[model samples]
Target: MRLAALPRRPSEPTITLINVVFLMLIFFLVAGQVAAPVDRDIQLIDAAALATRAPDDALAVRSDGTTLWRGEVTTPEAFAAARIADGAEVLRLVPARDLPAQDLLRIANALRMAGAAEVRLVTDRSAP
Candidate 1:
């Protein structure tokens, strides 16, 4: 009588690997929906006394007097218009410390023209 061939073993189940891949896919998919806030190219001017309250909208003014909108350089008119059109009632001006007073004034003017309900300047509080 011929010897019977040995039976081949079945491969291990791949449920664990499949589960891991499925989970990773889900993670990226969910994460993709949330975008990181854009940072304007304008350098931030940190103050010794910045307000604890957060501003509704941020406008960055670079040292060179360049303006940034959402981390990109933009004209004051354009930025202001966008916020006002979007119904942004409150606007915050975050200018670099080195930013000239004149530049700051320009921004304020633009905000007013855009019809902001309230415009607040973001400055660090002086040391007590």
Candidate 2:
């Protein structure tokens, strides 16, 4: 074994660095797609009593258990029929602030029995 000694091959750390850089690039691309970017310098508006837009298509239940659709007197069965006829499976209900819980449940059950697939209640964002 009198042959000349072979020089040691240099460790390839550059390949590992390149791999890490590519991985980070892919991760950032996915992360950036997940959320929209907001301007850091802009201050968002703050309001204590912002008025919420009431849903126009939602059924309104009064404190006395009366049902109204767009200000016209309506019943749960009629409302459900009208909504279903219009190809709407989901129903939105806006109950009065003083409406009883039992009345709400009874109305919801009636709507479900009349063929509503889902019923959702709309309320204000403010805490009482």
Candidate 3:
């Protein structure tokens, strides 16, 4: 009598691949830091040394001296007032690349006067 042959299983299933991809997606979402989105129109100035990550509470300043607070256009005075009222200790300023140094300094000064103990300027890292 001939012996019955055992059934063989497929080497790999599509479900395994899907599961691996899903796990990777979850890992990245949990491990990575989600930063607030910045306006595409605003170009940050380049610096030789700068922080690798963007600050959570960043204020964007346009070349024309316009300021964006929480994604809404606002005057510097208004922004400063709100920030002061909120008791923000650190003010992160992301100014446009074409913004004049005088303008940037003026904003920094205003923020200091508004009660920000530290005014951090955020700049793009220069290419090596």
**Quick one: best TM-score, which candidate?**
2
Q: After superposition, how far is residue 90 of candidate 3 from its true place, in Å?
A: 0.6
User: How would you encode candidate 3's per-residue C-alpha lDDT over 64-90 as one tens digit per residue?
Assistant: 988887778876667767776788777
Which lDDT tens digits does candidate 2 get at residues 63-97? Answer: 99999988799998999999999999999999999
How many angstroms is residue 41 displaced in model 3 relative to the true structure, after the best TM-score fit? 34
Clashing pairs counted in every model: 6, 0, 0
lDDT of 3 at 20: 94
RMSD each, Å: 15.6, 7.3, 13.9
By lDDT, who's the top model here?
2
Instruction: Give the TM-score (vs. native) of candidate 3.
Output: 0.51
Clashes of 3: 0
The local distance difference test score of model 1 is 0.78
Error of 1 at 28 (Å): 48
- Candidate 3 has its poorest 10 consecutive residues by lDDT at 47-56
